[model samples]
Target chain A: MLQALRDTLPANRWIRLVLLAIVLGVIFTPWLFDGTRALDTAARLSIFVVLAASYDLLLGFTGVVSFAHALFFGIGAYAVAIAFDHFAPGFGVLLVAIVAGLGVSLLVAFIMGLVSLRVKTIFYAMITLAVASAATVLVSQLYHLTGGEDGLTYRIPKVLTPAFKLLDDKVFGVRVNGKLMNFYLVVFSSIVLFLIMVRIVASPFGRVLKALRENDFRAQAIGYNTLAYRTTATLLSAAFATLAGVLMALWLRYTGPESVLSLDIMIDVLLMVVIGGMGTLYGAIIGATVLMLAQSYLQGLMGNAQDVIGGVPILSELMAPDRWLLWLGLLFIASVYFFPQGVVGRFSGPAPKEATT
Target chain B: MTTRVEPIQATGGEPVKQHRAWWHRPDAQAAVLVPALALLALPLTGDFSAWLTLTLAGLAMGMMLFIMTSGFTLVFGLMDVLNFGHGAFISLGAFFGFTVLAGLESWRLVDSLWLNLLAFGLAAVAAMIACGLLSWAFERVLVRRVYGNHLMQILITMGGLIVAEQLIYVFWGGEDWPMLKPAAFQGGLQWGDLVFEKYRLLAVVLGLVLFAALMAVFKWTRLGLLIRAGVENREMVESFGYNVRRLFVLVFMAGSALAAMGGVMWGLYDEVITAHLGQSIMITVFIVAIIGGLGSIEGCFIAALMVGLLSNYVGFLAPKLALVSTIGLLVVVLMWRPQGLVPATQGGQ
Candidate 1:
C-alpha cells in the first residue's frame, strides 16, 4: 500500500523524508489531533495539494499564467452544489455532479486554449483575467440560479453526513461517524489524483511541455504541436482542479463564490506553485503544506505575540490579524529574490540545468 | 517586446505621404469607432435624450478609465515591464485623496465653486505627490530588481500590491470610507431635453485637458522626444549618452502620479473609497491596456473610451449582457484587429 502510494518520489533524500512525514502526518491526523479544525485543516491540505500540483503542470511546466483557474474550480463546486439543490442527495446525484463538473471544466479549458492560440503569452494573462472578472460579475448578476453573494447550501448523501454511523463504537477515541468517512474519501481520492499527476508529469507528454516551456521555437522545430500540448495541459490541470473542487464541496456541503471562485484562491494556487518550486510536483506539495500551515497558524501566533507586546500602538497594529497579508507579501518577495528556484528547488539539487532556457 | 516603428523623415526622405487612404490608418479607424458606437446605441436606447445622456456619461466614464490606464500604458511602453502592482498606486491615491479632502472639508462645504475646485485640486495634488514618491521607492526597491524577468516581476509586484493593500487597511481601517462630493458640484446642469451631471462634466473636461496636455508634451518637448526615442530603442538612446534609467524612473513616477490622480477622480466619481478599489478595477485596466495595444497611449485612450461606452450602452440595452459586454467586445475587436487597434511597437506583439 505504501509502495502504491508513492508515485513520483522527490530526488533529494531530505525531500523524500519531508514527503513521507507529510503523508504520515495526514494519515495519523485523526489520532494526533483532537479538534474539528485540525481535521478540517487536513482535508483542506489534501485538496490544496492536488490543486497546487495541477497548477504546476500549467505554470511551472508549460509557462502559461492563467487567471481563470478559480473559475474552473468554481464551475466544479457550483456543479455539485446545483445538482444537489435540484435533485435528491444520493450517490447517483454525486456521480452526475462529478461528471458535470469535469465535463464543463474540460469544455471551458478547451475554449480558453483555442482562444489563447491567437495571442502572445502576456496577452493570455490579460484575457484570462478579463474572463475571470466577467465570470464573477455574471455569477453575481445571475443570482437566482447561482445564489449570488449569499451562496448555496445543500445536503450530501446520508453516509457522508455527520449523523451517519459507519460503526457503533468509537475508534481510538474518535467518533467513527460519517465525518471520518468524508475525510478518508477526500484523502483517498486526493492521493490517487496526486499520483496520477506525478505520473503524467513524468511521462513523455510532460517532457514535450517542458521543452516548449524552455523554448517554443525549438519545440516547434522538433515537430511537436505546441498548441495541442498546451491545450492538453490546460485540460488536464482544469480537470484535476475540478475534482479537487468537487471534493471540497462534498466535504463542506456548501458552495459560494468567495469559497471557490474568488481571485484570492487563484493567487494562493499561484503562490503555492511558485514559492514551492515551479516545474516540480514536489515543490507544489511543499508549497501547499507551507501555505496551509501559515494560513492556519500565522495569525494566531501573531496575536499571541501582540498580547505579549501589549499596548504598543504601532507594533500591535502591525501584528494585527489583518496584517498577516503584509508579512506574507514581504516573505513572498524575499523568496522570489532569494530562492528563484523556489523552496523545493533550493533544497533539492538544481534541475539538470537545461542551459537556463 | 516587439519591433519598433521607423521614423518618417520630413526632408525628401522618400515621399511617404502620398499613397494613403485615411481608412487604412488603424488609429484613425479606431478613433472613429467611439462616436460610431454612440450613434449605434442611440437607436437601441429609443429616446434621444436618454441616448444623449447615456452617451455623455459613457464618454465621461471612458475619460476616467483612460486617465487610470494611461500611466500603465506608458510604463509598459517605455520599460517593456508589466506592473501588476499598478493598482497599489490607485489605492494609495484614493486613500491620500480621501485624507486630504477630509482635512479640507471646511473649504468644500461652502457654495463657492472656486473654493470647492481649489479644495479638490489640493487633494489631487497631495495624492499625486504621495503616490509619485511611493512609486519611486516601489520601482527602486521592488520593480527594478525583477527587470527582464516577467514572471518574477509579476510575482514580486503582486507581493508589493498585497503589502500596500494591507498597509492601507492598517492605516484607514477595513471598512469603506465615504468620498464626499463638494457642495458646489452636487447638482446637474439642465438644458432643453438634455442633462449633465456637474461631476461628469468636470471629469470629461479634465480628461480631455489631460489627454491634450499629454499629446502636446510628447509632440513638442525634447524630453518627450527622448522618451519616445527611448521607447523605440533604449540601447540606442543609452548609447547617445542619455541616462535612460533615470528617464524611466522619472516616467514611472509621473505615470504612477497620474494613476493616483485618476484614483482620486474615480473616488469622487464613485463617491466612495476602499482599499480594494484598485483591485476591483484591475480587470478594466488590463482590458483597456490590451485593447489599446500595449504601450500605446493613443490606443489605450480609444480602448478605454470604447469599453466605457459599450459598458454603459449594453448595460442599459441588455441588463444580462452588462457584466460580460467588455469581454464580448474584446473578442469582436480582437477578431477584427489581432494586435489591437494600434500596435505601439509594430511587427507582431
Candidate 2:
C-alpha cells in the first residue's frame, strides 16, 4: 500500500497536500455544501479535472498537440446519450455505452495517430483541427440522432436519479439519496482514474515519453520505436477523455454539441491545462477548480459591471456577462507568454539560478 | 532511355525546369481536377445551363477562398509559423465592411452604378485598412514572442484567435446582422435561362485580377522576388543582407488584407454577418490551404476551386453534406498527394 501510495503521490509536498485537499473537499461535497447547484458544480469540477489532466498527458508529457480531444469526448458523450435514448435506462445500457465509447475512441485515436503522427507537428495540429471542426459540423447536422444542436435529454439508470435512495438513514446528516450516490460514483471513479494516470506517468512508459518530449531524434537514436510510444500516449489520453465525457453525461442526464463538442469547450480545456501547469496532474486539478469557480462567479460579476457601466458606451459592452471569455482568452495569452511553465510550475520548479555576474 | 524528370539543380530553391511538364508534374496533374469536377458535376445536373451556373458560382467562391488562404499559406511557407489566429482577420474584415457599408446605405440605395460601386469600394478599402493594421499588431505583439516554437505558436495564436473573436463579439452585438447589397448588384443577369448574380460576377473578376497581380508580384518585382526567396529559405535570404523580418511583416499584412477582402466579398455573397463568420469560413480556408499544399499560392488557388466547385455541387445535391464533401475532398487529395496539390519545393515541405 505504501509503494502504491508513493507511485500516485506528487513529489512536491505542497502540491500533494493541495491535491489531497481538493480531492477530500470533492469527496465530502455532499456533507459540506448545500443546494443542487453546488452539487452540480462539484460534479462538473470532477469531470473537468479528468478532462484537463488527460489533455495534459497528450500535450504536456507527449508533446503531441491535438485539437480533436473534444471530439473523442463528444463521442463518449453521444454514445452514452444515444444508448440511453434507444435502450432501457439501466446499468447494462451504461456499461454497453462505456465499452462502445472506449472502443470507438481507441480506434479513431489509433488511426489519427498513424496518419497524422507520421507527419510534422504543424501538419498534425492542422489535421486534428480540421477533423475536430468536421466532427462539430456532423454533430450539429445530425439533429435527428444527436437531437441536432439542441442535444438530447434522457433519464439515466433509475438508481442514479435523485428519487432512488441507497440507504434508508442519513449518513453524517447527509441523506443517502440517489443524487448523492451518483455524485460519489463520479467523484470516486474520477479519483481512481486520476491515480491510475499518475501511476502511468510515473511508469517506464512515461520515461520514454519524457525523452521523446525533450528531443524526438535523440529518443529515436536510443532504439525506441518513438512512433509506437506516441500512438500509445494518444490512445491512453483519448480513453481518459472519453471516460470523462461519460461521467459528465451520466451526471447531467443530458448531452449536446455545444456542451461537449464545441470549440469553446476545447479552448476551455486548453486554458485549464496551460494555466494549471502542463505535465503536472495536480496542477490540472487546481486549474480546473479555479476555472470552474471563475466561470460560476466571474460572469455574474461581469453582469453587474455591465449594468454599472451601461452608460459608458464601448466599455459597457466589455463588461457584459458573455464577455468573460474575452478575459479568459487574454489570460490564456498571458500564461503562454509570461509563464509557460504554468501556476504550479511557477512555485514548484526550482528558482532560476542567480547569475554569477 | 533515361527520363529527364528530376530537378537539375537541387539548390533548395524552387522554380525548377520541371515546371513545364504537365503530365509528369503532380501539381499540374492536380489542376485537371477543376475541369474534371466541373465536367462530372455537369452530367449530374442534367442540363448545361444549371451546370454552367453552378460552375460559375463555384469559380467565384473558389476565388474568394483563394484570396483568403493565399496569405495564410504564404505566412506558413515563409516563417514556418502556423498562425492559428489568422481567422480573426477574416472576421475583422467582415465586421469592418459591415460597419463601413452600414454607414453608406444612402450611397448604396442611390441606384447609380458609380455610387454603388463607390460605396462598396470604400467599404472594401476601409475593411482592408482595419484588417491590415490589426494584423501588424497581431504579428508584433502576440505572434512575435512565439516564433520558432510550433507548439507555443499554436497555443498562443489560438489564444489570439479566441481573444480577437471575443473582442468582435464585444463590439458587435451577439446577433447575426443581415448585410444589404448595393441596389445595382442585388440581382443577377439573365443569360437565356440562367441567371448570374452581378456580385458573384464581380467576385470572379476581382479574384482573377488579384491572382494576376499576385502572380506578377511573385514573378516581376523586387518585393516579390524577396518574398519568394524568403519562403524558400528564411535564413539564406536573411544572410544575403536583406531585412527578411520586415519583409515578412509586409507580406503578413498584405496577406491579411487580402483575407479581409475575401471576408468582405463573403459578407456580400452570404448577406449575413455573424460573429462566427471567421470561424465558419476558416474550416474551408484550412482545408483549401492543406489541399493546395501549405505554402503554395497557385496550389491554394487550384485546391480552392476544386473545393469550391465540389462544395457548391454537393450543396446543391446534398445540402446536409456540404462540409463533409470538402473534408472528403481533402482526404482524397491528401491520400493522392500528401504534400498537397502543389507542394512547395523547400521550407520544410
The global C-alpha lDDT for each of the candidates, from Candidate 1 onward, is: 0.85, 0.87
DockQ of each: 0.59, 0.53
Quick one: best DockQ, which candidate?
1
Off by over 4 Å in 1: A1-8, A351-357, B1-18, B346-349
Give the C-alpha miss distance for residue A346 in model 1, angstroms.
0.9
Question: Candidate 2, residue A170: CA error in Å?
Answer: 3.4
Q: Give the least accurate 10-residue stretch of model 1 chain B, judged by summed lDDT.
A: B340-349
TM-score of every model versus the real structure = 0.95, 0.95
lDDT of 1 by residue, A1-357 (tens): 344335345557888889889888987899998799999999999999999988888888887888888888888889999999989999998899889889989998898789774456677777888898888888877888889987889998889888999899988788889889999999999999998888787778878998988888899999998888988999999999999999989888889889989888988888788778888787878888888888989888988988999998778888887677788777778877788667777777655332122
Docking class of 2: medium
Please identify model 2 stretches exceeding 4 Å from their true place: A1-14, A307-310, A351-357, B1-20, B346-349
